[model samples]
Target: MRNFEKNIKNKAYAFQLDPMPDSFDKVMDALEKKKKRRFIFWLWILIPGFLIAGGGLLINQMYSSANAQVQAQSLKASHLLTVLFKENKQGLVHEDKYALTETTHTTTPENKMNNRPTSETQSLASKNNQPVFIKESSNQSAEFNNRNEKSFVQIEEKTNMTQVPSREKWTPIIFSNPYFVTFPTHSSNPVYSRTQIPFTKSTLPVIKSNSHQTGRWSIGIYSDLGVSKNIFINNKDSAGFGYTNARQLTDKFLFSYSAGIQFRYSPVKWLAIETGIGFTHYESNQLLSNAGFSWTTSGNNNDPDTALTLSSVDPQSAFGPYEYQNVYDYISIPIKVYYQKKWNWTGIEAGGGIIFDLPVNTHSYVADENSNMSYLRHEVKTSRLNVFGIQASANIHLVFHIKKFGLFAGPTFKYRMNSMFDKNYITRQHNYFIGGEMGLRYHF
Candidate 1:
């Protein structure tokens, strides 16, 4: 605080100065000289070292080659000497074994006792010339060999030959292959007996069958349910029922269903002729707002009427906020032709044909809106439903086959081709239905 600023300027200062530029040049020169000296030293040392290594390897290869040649020659000479020595020894033994001997019988007691030498002086290899080997007869060898080893080398050969089967007689087990070739054998052994079975192509049944495959009969049962619509099918184009055009009545068409049994015949692989009898139930629903639009043709559930004619009477009445049902039941007979195709497990068939239906009856019922439209019924009878009619239909089905039974399902369409009443009858209906059908069938 007293004189700090003045003392700072008076303090001794040190600064490092850069080396002179020439100093860099001197350092680089020294490095180059040092590197050159190392290069020269290694060049002189490596050349002579490589020469020495190369010469030593060459000398070693020459010496090893010469040594190996000498070892091979020595081994061959030793093997030859061994073979010659064995041959000479065997020749000497052979000569000694059959040395010439005079025929003398040692019968006298004095001669026998003198001839029977003992210990080292015995007749082992004396120059007296005696036979040490004997030519063997079959009986002697067999009899003597059995004394200790029980026919060691003699009978053992015959026994082994009898035990082992010969290669020519060996019958390999040809595992049970039905298609294998059978060879004939004359051997009495049961194992060698092979009975040849002659199989001809004519013995096999053909894959293309001629029976139920085509020209056959089949039977089935089917059922289907879907929407139904009734329309006027006349040349007059006449419209009636004044309250509503039947189909325009709110909620006009709901559902129709049928169940039936069918008998079908196939005349060829791809074509079928079928006929069936079935029961059909058709229904239509209509909404009533202004106290039910009525059907004058019906007798209001056959209720008591004051007037003469049922329609002139109280005339069926229904209230608002209710659903009315018009129902028709029919006994249907169908004549159809189908194009059928089949495979191992599944098939498809599609065809179109005509059907005839005889109406069983017609009835009308009602359901209250408060009841969630459940069928609360009130029916009226009418003779107008007995008319016979005809229809055209087409169907396609996918069939799943299991053995003799087949299950089939697909879409079906049918349209009434004719009016369901006499020509003069009013309110003629030609009903048509669209729905899926399923059936079960059996093959013979």
Candidate 2:
């Protein structure tokens, strides 16, 4: 054993003295070197890289500006060229059409014959440098000749003049002329002129008016489920037919269902209000223990057994354990004004409001035969529960948009402001309660 101990000690000593690098020291050296490279190398890389990026951005902007200026100049030149060409073409067309029209008109002479017109009278007329002769005999006379000469002179003097003369004899017929017509034979056609149009202000296409604006009001059913204390306890030692004043009885559930109007204001989404009357039901159950201490004054019946009962050493033996089931049904009117910030029509809301409950009724079921099953019921009948109440709860809502309707489902916590059972029961010992509910809501 001594040798064994010495061998172990020798091995331990060898291991302790071995020359080896500590992992912590190596790690610290590596970390320090990495930190040094990170600061120096990263800074070196980032400074140059950022400078390059900024330079590239500046170059891009300069190039874009130059290109835009060139494009603008080109567009302006093209527009001016188009306008000039259009005006020049229009003016040339107008001049050509007007010249053609002016050269196309002609004039003609007119003559009217009476007696000579009864027969086929072939007359010769002269135009330009051609001569036209009529078949009137020279055998008429000098007077007739003179008259004919005079008429010829008159006709030659006024080329476009109109004359009216009556015809008498065939040997030397006097002609009646209504108009003088001069035919040009060749005339140019009329020309149509087109004028250059001036530039007018240009406008982009305008879209028609929009028809997408809308206003909406919805009808819906809203509900809340909550729980509140039935009786607020001030002193723990006080006698009562409910949970001890020290340890309070929590309300299980006060669920309400109502139908009301829902309204929405646009631009501010997820904001709305609901108003309606609801049927609210609240129920609670508790186990109550009766105190066996009793006292009677000396003025009572002087029977010996009565004295024994009054002065009993163990008064708890007179009663059995019992359970109480409390139920409250009320017609509640709830005006809940809630606001919601919705994410895709699904969100959460927190609201609190007053619930006016006309206590329809309250019933208590005693667990044992010795229990005064009608004690609490008789009290309710005497004074129907007209209680002012308040409930506060938060709910996660799922809004389903089906055409113009909405369906929602979520959990809610509702509490009655006042206790269901009048805790001031003269004969009951203690009251305790616990409950929960589920509900649905619809919107239109």
Badly placed stretches (over 4 Å) of model 1 are: 1-211, 233-241, 244-246, 249-251, 288-318, 365-382
Clashes of each: 0, 27
Number of the predicted model whose TM-score against the real structure is largest: 1
User: For model 1, what is the alpha-carbon lDDT of residue 287?
Assistant: 43
| Reference-based lDDT, each prediction | 0.45, 0.32
lDDT of 1 by residue, 1-444 (tens): 458765764563444479864568658976985686567446445543554455344433332223223323322222111100011112121211211112232222222322322211111110122212121212111111223322111110110000011121211111111121111111122111122222232222101112242227889998866678866433232344432243344444556788899998888768889899999988765543333343322112223321113222224422333344677788889999989877534578999788888877776433211111112223443433436778898999876554355667778999988765444343355678987677777767
Error of 2 at 52 (Å): 55
Measured on C-alpha atoms, candidate 2 has an lDDT of 0.32
Q: What is candidate 1's CA lDDT for residue 88?
A: 18
lDDT of 2 by residue, 14-122 (tens): 8855433355665787699579656744654554355445544543333222322332332222211110001122222111110001111122212222113212212
**Estimated TM-score for each candidate:** 0.43, 0.35
